[model samples]
Target: MTLTLPPAPHGGPRAGRHLVDAALWPDVARLPRASALRTAVARRIVERAVRRLPLRVRTPGAAAPALPRQPRGSADGLPTLILHDPGAFFRRIGADGLIGFGESYMAGEWDGDDLVGVLTVLAGHVDDLVPQALRRLRGAWVHRRPASDRNTVDGARRNVHRHYDLSNELFATFLDPTLTYSSAVFASLPAGAEDLSAAQHRKIDRLLDLAGTGPGTTLLEIGTGWGELAVRAARRGARVRTVTLSREQRDLALRRVAEAGLRDRVTVELCDYRRVDGTYDAVVSVEMIEAVGAAYWPAYFGALHRLLAPGGRAVLQAITMPHERMLHTARTHTWISKYVFPGGLVPSREAIARHSAAAGLSLVHDTGYGEHYAETLRLWRERFLGRSAEVSALGFDHVFRRMWELYLAYSEAGFRSRYLDVRQLVLTGRTTADRGTG
Candidate 1:
């Protein structure tokens, strides 16, 4: 059923005073104190780890009572780390490990002269931060994925609501006019904010092209992100059916489809992909696989295989990590998983290939554009920071803003350091004759 919602003032939900009470926006001001021994150990480990890296860790007035001796690292031409509250930083890291590091930043305990650069250097050396002996015992100390973040149907809906159902104005402040939340494949390596809309269209068109979308073609989109892809497909003369779990996205997407006068050609449903039933000439899902969770990857791939008609194709744009790294951290919960996108895990290219092949889908084409994602995030971060007042007016506090800023910068650094990737993949069904060879 098409659920109708009264449009907000600007074609979205009422933005102001809605997100301040969001569950993800945790209060960072009140935290449990760490024992003195734990704090001392954390401070020592942090100082030793950063000592040989390209970082300049310092406190105000050249010295402070909390941090008596500043570490002398390879600081020439490196990013400077300014510690506002050294005691809090130590306590947080000592207690929560990496999650605490991110929380410390959100709590205003530290600031960096070059946020992305600092994160990039740290990301490059992430696997080496701890000693080999301690690394082997990570499972004992690291946070485990919570049972609630399991990505079951109910859990998935709740997780999606936690992030995507936040005020739409919050996303509109940073994203392009189309409201695309994924990475844009730009024609040039680094495009300006003015070019983001065109880049997003370009990205969508490429996926459509891979899907062979055209007149009279039946296109099914697994993720309906603001209805831009549906509108574009409808304009190309294709019949489009797109589904999303987000109510906010569905409401705005329906409004956008109407605004474009393509309501007859496009159908937007507030449904999950697994619940949709149809045979289409093409299926396209952009950057949605990350939220499928590793355990459900096979089910996700099987759904794509089952929904395609004869000679049909499925295209996906996914954020990926190294296969070994993905396996190592598959069950571990990090700050991003906790604060930004719950129940999310980026799959590896190999994992995608293996899962789809098992589901009778043949991998056809794969393209990586991590640099484009890096550039895309840089533009978003700058735009988001520039519009701080507007974001604040939307009822988000400084801690929420800091957490979001850190999320963007952390992701950008992952791409910049080659620790993360974004890829486009095309898959086709396997014929009975072809299935015998494997």
Candidate 2:
């Protein structure tokens, strides 16, 4: 049955009052009798659906809040948040559906007196979002695809370009000066003193320490973002080779290396890690595995193993989910695969261990710093928002800014809530008898 909403309310005073009128009785006075009957049926269905949730409607405060104008069809079963400027709310809902609600906040479409409080309430009631959860599961099943060659090189490049190549200026405005585009390690910070640059340095130092890096050592970096780690390694007297698919990253990293007079000791290549063949004293990949896709984990680990010298160690840092016997529901996975990070899936610890073991690598040390990542992202978001004007001037439009903001904030929330984790694993390819710590 078709559903019809009431005519948009008049502008100016009493505009808030008309929200109820439009939501309850959208204009259908002149419609045919059959059409009117269908509208009524749809309205009843919507009303019943809304009633099923524990929503607490509040009066408009200073702003004429918008309610969900779209008909609460089966696809719109998720709960909605009433907001000031209901027109903006309708626009978001129409544009992105349930996801739009969160996106709108990132876009600054609506603001609450207490955003954190509202989020807490919504998070507390997440269990009531069963229908949305089911939709996610259904999406996973109906949209499975094989991880083919196109998915790895070209497809992955396109995805990276869409997000990372937006502009180096934009990234530098928010990211730490080092421009290390990965999770940071904040091990030695007093409660709130964890700065991005400091944390990134700690991560680099941790990797170097784990690999037993020293002068004359050869270090290989997979997925070099802006080449900060390579430069740092070279500064410590180690020759470094880094590989990345992002053209922007390679060009900028190489320029930085040259500027530092480390061109002879450091090289950044626009290449895939699988194609890279070399034996190095140490290897590292920071936040690169997400794009490798779960099916390719074994190949990725094997590639790292081959690149490392006997008794040499490799340090890897990536985001992960808690152990799950099965992958995420289709709907959630598809959203990430489509809108966020195409060909990306966060592997569990068990999955990582199994894959590494199959690749002839033994985990020597493992650390979880998921909470530090949350703090890192939060700092990035604050910096990004603080420099919004500069970012916009750097050619980021509304949609692009919104996408980045949502990506940063949601990632922070995921880590903070423990729904996501960041892990650093030190692996050695030597046998137990050789290293004695297999």
Which one wins on lDDT? 1
Candidates in order, TM-scores: namely 0.89, 0.74
Q: What ranges in model 1 sit over 4 Å off?
A: 1-27, 63-76, 192-194, 430-438
Q: In order, how many clashes per candidate?
A: 0, 9
Question: Roughly what TM-score does model 1 have, to 2 decimal places?
Answer: 0.89
Q: What lDDT does each candidate get?
A: 0.83, 0.66
Q: Candidate 2 lDDT, tens digit per residue, 1-438? A: 222233224442222223223332222111112233333333343333344543322325533223334435534333334344444444434333345455445444454443333343344444453355444443322334434313466777776776677678888988999998787877654327756788889888888888777799999999899988898889889999999888888889989999999999998888888889878989988888878877678889989888888778899987887664226422243434545677677788888899999999889899988777777877788899899999989866655665577667667756665767888889999643554342
Model 2 residue runs over 4 Å out of place are: 1-128, 131-137, 140-150, 187-195, 329-333, 431-438
Error of 1 at 100 (Å): 0.5
Query: How do the residues 138-257 of candidate 1 rate in per-residue lDDT, one tens digit apiece?
Result: 764468989899889999999999999998999999998989999988887757434889888999999999999999999999989898999999999999999999999999999999
Error of 1 at 130 (Å): 0.6
